[model samples]
Target: MTTDPPPEPTGAPAPTSTARGARLAFRRWRRTRPFWAALWTGTGGFVIFFLPMAPLGQILQVGVGGIAGMSGGVVLMAMALLILLLPGQRHTAGVIAVIAGVASFPLSNLGGLFVGMALSVLGGSMAFAWLPEKPARRRGGRGLLRRTRSAAETPVPPVSVGSGSP
Candidate 1:
């Protein structure tokens, strides 16, 4: 026997169960802000931060390196959060992240073995390059190449004839 689906309440909208719905929602959320930049920067920061804790021989014992790495990583991570929280300040965050990533190299286990440095730099670049969406100017589904009637309706003034030799 086939089981019947449960009935929904009269006024409530049915919940979406499909993964596609989730994906669409995520896409919409991503388009509105610098989501990828934040993710990459944060990941890089975490890598940099965790490397000091990892038991790599002689890696963490270097004088001041461990502290430097942790500090740089924390800065990068904070920049990522700032980018996500205040998109208008993304440029500032991006610049700070890049500087921190570069500084981490000599300070933090070679910038978490170079992985964290690369990721943070890349994320910062992406954030700096990101642009906000512009509102569409066209109405009535007009194509960019299509000319408006107003332009075509305007009459070109006839060229006036003048004596060549005065």
Candidate 2:
């Protein structure tokens, strides 16, 4: 024989407001990080770009590529900055760094090899560091994450037969 499920009561107050507030707060925090990262990266990149393409380029044979190269540097800076600032999955900071580092070589002078590498590493490091880490367990693996599965994947348990009467 089949058993009927208990009726879910309606007209109850929802606790969704707290969840909404938490979501909003997380979103704001998420947005703020990359904002700062982008700003710093862009500023540092432009400084590197201008130093070579405008002034130092005249003296150093390394900076001879002109606007295209400088533009490339800007692009690299933007990418690197984004990688660091954003919260999502981006293991590509290394790739972005490679491009920026290589391109920065001619623009910043051969001496720039050192500087460019440093900047590239800095960009990657900043992104890695900027990402939020989950707090450690207060009671040794007793956190919510330990007991829960994603809603989509959770299995529903089966019910048994009658309990009291034979």
Candidate 3:
């Protein structure tokens, strides 16, 4: 008598390549918390520094303050961009940003003082909180999930010799 081969099993649908890539990208981005914080703060700094100009002109009747205000806002914006560019040096950059934000207040840009200080301080705090993650090692070498042994490594049960049978 001949036996047919076992039927193939089918169940879950496979994920598409695009879905897999997106998942990987998301994971990579999620791991870099400090980088995201820096980026957001930098963007907010730029917007806040420039957004007040029109309002200031309408309210205070100053198209633009003297060089001190302009330079301070420019410097704060520059520091924010610098932080975004150098995530590895986030702590140092963040501290500098916070200091610059404070200085911007006394320099005549109150808008920069509030928005820049709040965002930069938060970003700096995040940078301080971030910890470097270790690289994942291959399985079977003191890893969390060890690989199962191949068929070659499987032990064979010994057969009894010369057993009496009908």
Judged by lDDT, which candidate is best?
1
TM-scores for every predicted model = 0.71, 0.44, 0.53
Taking every candidate in turn, the Cα RMSD to the unseen true structure, in Å, is 5.9, 19.5, 18.4
lDDT of 1 by residue, 57-125 (tens): 655566577877888999999999998889899999999999999889999878989999999999998
Model 1 spans with C-alpha error above 4 angstroms: 1-12, 17-23, 54-61, 140-166
Extract clashing residue pairs from model 1: none
- The worst-scoring run of ten residues by lDDT in candidate 3 lies at 139-148
In model 3, residue pairs whose N, Cα or C atoms come closer than 3 Å (at least 3 residues apart or on different chains), thus clashing, are none
Candidate 2: stretches off by over 4 Å: 1-44, 55-64, 111-113, 125-131, 136-166
User: What value does the lDDT take at residue 101 in candidate 3?
Assistant: 59
Q: What is candidate 3's lDDT per residue for 114-148, written digit by digit as tens?
A: 77556655665666566768777765664532245
Which order, best to worst by lDDT?
A: 1, 3, 2
